[model samples]
Target: MSAVGLTYLTLILIAYGVSSCSSKEKTQRSLKIAGLSLWRLLPLLAAVFGLVGLFQVFLPPELIEKTLGESSGVASLLLGGGMGAVAIGPPAAAFPLAGTLLSAGAWPPAIAAFIVSWVSVGVVTLPFEAGVFGMRYALVRNGIAFGAALLIGLLMGLVL
Candidate 1:
């Protein structure tokens, strides 16, 4: 487990100990409900982690380098956007992926764009985003994010 996971476990243990010592039925009931909520959330979290692991295993660094490496032009931008589209994991997964890409010779601009759009503009999450924030809002946000990612990538390529 990660350090954050361990820390959360420790905190939960401490809370459980204190709650159990209190001998209050209401508190116990509340704790049970909270535990159930955590249990329900666990599966989704596990799936996300599993997907991240799968991506790391299947999409090797060399493939990313071959596709997006040192290409300064429209092709590089499109490659970056496509890479961003495919990457659906959290920051934890993205960091390792970015490092691997860098080691495999992917340009900084492309990697930066990929990382930014990977997090900021998610097609997978679009339905939920649209539901919560309206379709127009979601569309505009994604469009701007995609454009910004390209601009940032191009600027980084020029500067670095």
Candidate 2:
């Protein structure tokens, strides 16, 4: 298990122990808080997991390797960036996709860029983002994220 999973398990154990030893009111309060937290996080978790499955079904590793893995210098970089823009999903979703791409022989730098841009910059969620955060904020944030992803990819190519 991951460190995060282990930590969550440890916390649950501690919470159970404490609830058992506490007064009824305190135990009830703790349970309510925990329930509320889980309720709040459920939608976000579901969205990420759903996106992950959808990506797995739609864009296979072979396609990623074929397009972005080409060695055409600037054209390849643009292709990588474009691919990232097209694939809209969460970071959790992108990790598995990145693994698949790597296994299919995609360059590490391209995969890194694609994953980072996929999450950090979201063309698909633009309307929702603009509605909540304002168009200017959404546009600027995405623009910066896109540029940063490209720069990061180039640096990774150079360093690694």
Candidate 3:
């Protein structure tokens, strides 16, 4: 780990140790909850990182730069937003991928749109959302999310 990361880990460990000493039962309960949450999220975490590895290998940086570069303009926004909406997994995956895109010459607006839409929009989860919240609600929410993402991308491009 980096020095900063090691320092943070040390601090967290010290704090956790102190907390456990102060209240054993509470600490145990908290640990149990944390463990359960970790277990629940492990599969998703694995899948996302695995996908990221594949993405890094399969998608040429040249393609990303060409399609999502600053000069790509509105097309970049649309493509990024559309890709974000369709792509599944988590914000964890999006952030790293966005960084990669940015380093490869993608504009800030496109990257921002991608991250926002990836977190908020969910075309892949539509069926589940509809099953729980109704089809119309899901569709409307996704549509609004998409529209707002584009607008945010436009404004960001102008401001930044």
lDDT of 3 by residue, 32-144 (tens): 99899888878887877776677678888778878998788889988999989998865866777787778777888988888888878998899999999999999999999
- Residues forming the 10-long window of minimal summed lDDT in candidate 2: 70-79
Candidate 2, residues 1-160, lDDT tens digits: the string is 8999999999997878877786778877887998997787678768766755676678776666666674555666666676787776446566766776666667777777787788778888888899999999989998999888888988998898
User: Which candidate gets the maximum lDDT versus the true structure?
Assistant: 3
Residue 60 of model 2 has an lDDT of 73
Q: Against the correct fold, how does model 2 do in TM-score?
A: 0.60
Model 3, residue 63: C-alpha shift (Å): 1.5
Clashes of 1: 0
For residues 1-160, could you state the per-residue lDDT of candidate 1 as single tens digits?
A: 8999999999987887887788678678977898897787676667666765675678776666667777545776778776785668665566666666676677888888988999998888888999999999999999899889888888988898
| lDDT: the better of candidates 1 and 3 | 3
- List ranges where model 3 is wrong by over 4 Å: 14-23, 39-59
Candidate 3's C-alpha lDDT? 0.85
